[model samples]
Target chain A: MDQLYTPSTEKCELVSASKGTVKFLLDYSKSLSIVKAEGMVFENNLN
Target chain B: MEHQTDDSTLVQDYISGDERALEILINRHNQRITSFIYSKVLDRDAAEDIFQDTFIKVIKTLKKGNYSEEGKFLPWVMRIAHNLIIDYFRKNKRMPKFEGGDDFNIFSVIGDEKPNVEKQLIKDQIDSDLSMLIDELPDDQRDVLIMRIYKDMSFKEISECTGVSINTALGRMRYALINLRKIIQKNNIVLTNY
Candidate 1:
């Protein structure tokens, strides 16, 4: 009896929450990539 | 040229003190790993901090010759990221309660308060965050979440399709909801109709 279940719009919001989080991560990773690339270029110039 | 390289090769190179290889590996898995952490914490600055911490741990573990899981480098690093997310929760003294030491059920704790027009933008932002986080869930849990939330499948049907017990499917859904609520609270997500 304790395990009865029901669905709500909140559940849908949960899915949306995860989707937005991943999108942010992808966007942030791009900035990190640019920084890494610049560092690599500098290192190559030094060598 | 680096695009054709596989993870194990990069891991071995890193173990041999080739920092460039580690950089390539990070570049390869950074988005997925970052997304996974952001899904749990839902804070950009916090996610970035944990992201850096995760890679620091990866470097230390590899340098110490303790990375035993060969050919599974990304998953290993992700495990580290997940653990750090859990550590963040524990450290903040806001860790979600788990049932039977497995499933985290926080639906009851999530307030049913409705947001007004003034908080519409904030609610929209939170909704977007939730969307991305769901994509980063572990395969099994994500599958259950998608089936239950998006596909609107019953736990019995989920078990039939995934070949797990009904209880396992139910547990996954519970954990999914709990994790979502935790991220929502941690990030100050404001729910509203828009």
Candidate 2:
């Protein structure tokens, strides 16, 4: 198994550079999840 | 020392009478905000309308000097847009709501019972910067990362489909993250949820 890289403070500093990008991606993913959930519900309703 | 006027100052200026300030603010955030709305709704026209309404509420709220959180302009605006999208879905009867105790309602679809339009628009309106970063990764790394993220596939599944070992798939994902960090350092990409 590939060991997960634990983000240290220095690594976090590197991450901070793209903090906005990361946060946006996360929010986008979350919204997509909700949308998918809605779709599943819609499909279920149809059956 | 040079004076640095933040978004709050710009908002204050707009509230005081400078149209240019508000214009600058809109120009700065419009694309991300619009893209966010589009991701949720998947309908361009509806997204546009919601985007407009979001700003209209922002303007009205600001004009009334109701915005006390000066440094939080973007976050405030994001909340407005999110709420408006929810409102839109609720009004259209597309959002599922449970009613009449014991009635387990999931997603409510009003009007015609048509096939769900879920599979067509799986692209979650990924913002340009993240997309650029993903595009910059090496092919093997990018492939594994996309399968894990956009497809929500497990590493084993990714390996099965890509014909790579599970360990190799996981390694590729880890390397993708490392490479992404390097790219962010080189390009100075700033990521913000708001």
> Lowest-lDDT window of 10 residues in candidate 2 chain B?
B117-126
Candidate 2 residue lDDT tens string, A1-47: 34576543332221111234334332332232111353342111111
State the DockQ of every prediction. 0.03, 0.02
User: What's the distance in Å from true for residue B179, model 2?
Assistant: 66
lDDT per residue (tens digit) for residues A1-47 in model 1: 64576443332222112344444433333323111353342111111
Interface RMSD of each: 8.8, 15.0
Q: Residues B1-194, candidate 1: write the lDDT tens digits.
A: 88898888888886776767766776677677777777778666677778877876666566556678654887887888889998998987775543443464465457557665667767777678778878766778889999988899988999999999999998888888788777767778656544
> Residue B185's C-alpha lDDT in candidate 2?
88
Q: Summarize candidate 2's per-residue lDDT along B59-148 as a digit string, tens digits.
A: 666655567875589889889999999998998786444344556444452444653355223333335678889999999999999999
Which pairs clash inside model 2?
A19-B191, A20-B191, A20-B192, A21-B191
* Top candidate, metric DockQ: 1
TM-score of chain B of 2: 0.46
